[model samples]
Target: MKPNDLSTSSFIGWTCKLLAILIIVSLVVDCSSKKDVYYCPMHPHYTSDRPGNCPICNMDLVKKEDTSEHKDHSNASNSLQAAESISNEDHSSHLSETSSEKNSRELILSFEKQQSIGIKTELVSKRNLVKKISAYSSVAYDPELYSALSEYKEAVRSSEFLSPEIIRNLQLRLRQLGLSLDQIRIWTSGARDPSELILGGKSGRAHIYSQIYESDFTTVKVGLPIKFKTDVYPEKEFIGKIKSIDVILDKNNRTLRLRSEVSDPSQLLKPQMFGDTVIQVSLPNVLSVPTSAILDTGKQKIAYVQTAPDKFQAVSVQTGKNIEPWVEVLSGVQENQRVVTESTFLIDSEAKIRFGSDSHAH
Candidate 1:
């Protein structure tokens, strides 16, 4: 094509391209003008074109307040007094909604606070809370059985390896030595065999060296069936019949010795197993509460009494054996009174806010 004709074509093409670009730019601006940006009420710094939670405070994004939405009530009433009454009515409705929103906000805050603190509670009842006692006791082996096994160990070593006639001769010699034949047989076949003794000779018994309070022992009956468990074998339970309750106090350990017979012959029960033992006592018509509801601080125990919706009053309690998820309440609390089963801590916190320093005192 000729140079003049080509230059004219190029100018026309460039003009068309610029016109398209202007149209696109105009559309983008027009769309942006119609769109709205939102922000968070709690954290004002958070702003976004799309609605969502505030990145800084996790509060919901709200629409920016627009003053233009207010109605022009200038002509609603002709007289000044009438206009004033209308204005007051509108103001009251606005205030009512504001108060309701505040109440809802407080409820949400309380729920979240209770959840984060892991508060839980139980109900209080006054039916004869069982007069019970729970105390730790050490395990021990029978002293007589333990001593008999020690003597057998020495005699077995010679007999287990000896020939039949040699064994006979040894037995006759033992009899001549003035030891009874029963003793000889016991050495040969009984715990005298080192392998027969399950627990070590000296360390055979799990020693219970701890002591119980003198008054606590009075309620315990001799020959009462005892059921217990230990940490070593958590799934296994051991039951024993009380053989004797020692009247003499152990001065060194300051604990009373309560001898018991193993209910079952299974060797599953071992010494040094530390777990709770339940000594069934006769507590006539005693009331009990779910152990999960009680907050125990060792020196004293406390439970929250539900007075109203989400409202509770702290009550001091005397607790007995804990069966886990349930506890024996010796005194304090009444029947059918709902306690904060899941979020008692929230009530405790509110109580703290109401009475600073003394919140958890009870």
Candidate 2:
């Protein structure tokens, strides 16, 4: 053969070999791309290139469908099965926890769903739960009460002339005038004059009367410090300690009368002058959560605690005093745990739908 013919033959063979190698490489690449992918049944987002257990839920990963249409159908079926299994598992766990836990139900929400529902969380922590009681107050002035006291004192002095029934009626009149036995006893005993009790005496002090709700009757004690501000002295704060609390609650308005002797050296407070009173009662070093986080179902109190990202568990808690914006968590929750604050009702509705109505029943 000619030398040019031999070189042409060698080049043609090399070209054919290169084409065959390229075809084989293409086939291998295509086959690798077509290999089955595995994903966690419980956590579909967790996938593996090969068969293995899901790192997240520890469930075996199942083969994922390749086609879009088939994948959607398969995912729906798998989700239903996973939900059923999870419900069964949770039911067993809940039964076992009945002895220790008051009530429990686990719930999972996707990030997108959580964003759509505007869920918010807050950390459970130990803090001073300060309860602030606000009430309407006014400088005290009772002419009728003063007259009644004078009559009672006169009756006491003239007991020899007055009958027993008349003196007892006089004392009953003082009690009806909203004086406790202690106050009537003190004034009649001449410990302090009735005028000093009603009006500012030589001590330059004034009497202030505040009406607090029946709900705060236990919180407002005799010696609790109170602060008041009148429109006339908006910038200034008047201070006092509760001197007395009415033994009887006002039946009509459900309020208890609190009498506090305010330091009025300037005598800025006048009779019937209206102001706002605030009584702050501090509860120290208690485990607390946001008030919004608690769901009081009459019989039981439930709080949702975030155990993982987008996951929450319903916890039955014993609540103490409701310090607005926060509440005392006496049990069933720990400090530093995150609790669902906003959209808690929405999550609870979802939990009911998923875990059945009795999921949180005690």
Candidate 3:
């Protein structure tokens, strides 16, 4: 073969090989550009070149179709419409829940039903509530008290021989027996016998002893008018003024001792005679509501207020002193507001039925 012909054959073979390699490279680049893109159905923004679960919602990733530009625009518009529809549906559901919750807080009663339930209301107002504290009483002839007073007197007389601590201890004993500091000072300073204070003195003034519960300690005062009626003299009423109240309460019975001086001119009153005593306590200018309006749930005090015509709402209240038929309102209802003074428990039951127990949790 000639040398030129051989060289031409080799050149032709190299050109064919180069054209094949160029075609193969173009095919690989086109296939890579057309690869499928995957995206999460629940979280559309999360996309990947391969199929897998979405990191956000753990939903399967779906393949995105490769379509014409116009088809892509159409799909985008459809997705937007679907998203808006879902948003509107969620907003409507929220509105429905809010309306349902609002309706649960109130209870309605018809006029006929109100009458049947004996429902009544009263205005919250400031008033002077008078409380009558009644307690058992007896004509004073305390032998233990007399002995303590006598020891104190004897100690004072022998002051030269008795240590100061001994005398002070005797005075403390008198105090423990229910004598106030002023009463002790008076008895110790005077030469008169202690019997004059316990029994009827020459002036026909007899001591009356009564006890009040610790619950009434705040309402009682030194000069409150007290009336005593004894079984011995059932027809007569003995009048007196509170002279002193014990500084300490009795630990066992939770009561405070009260001493009063009553006029017994007829000398009919005798020691240890059983009687009943009434003390008048006046609480002035305090905000209060009717006792029936308060429903004590043991854990909380609740009052029902008429918020609208035939509609009632439960409100929590803090209460103070209770003077029968009237109770002090520390908080919850405003003055002049109307509260259900009757059928409060029924209203509370209705509220619990309508709104569950949390309706009046405040």
Candidate 3 worst ten-residue window by lDDT: 196-205
CA RMSD of each candidate after superposition: 23.8, 23.9, 7.9
Ranking by TM-score: 3, 2, 1
Q: List the residue pairs that clash in candidate 3.
A: none
Over all chains combined, what TM-score does candidate 3 have?
Answer: 0.75
- TM-score each candidate: 0.37, 0.60, 0.75
> Residue by residue across 135-164, what tens digits does model 1's lDDT show?
465455344434444444444575666566
Error of 3 at 50 (Å): 15
- Candidate 2: 10-residue stretch with minimal lDDT: 98-107
When 1 and 2 are scored with lDDT, the better candidate is: 2
Model 3, C-alpha of 191: deviation from truth (Å): 8.0
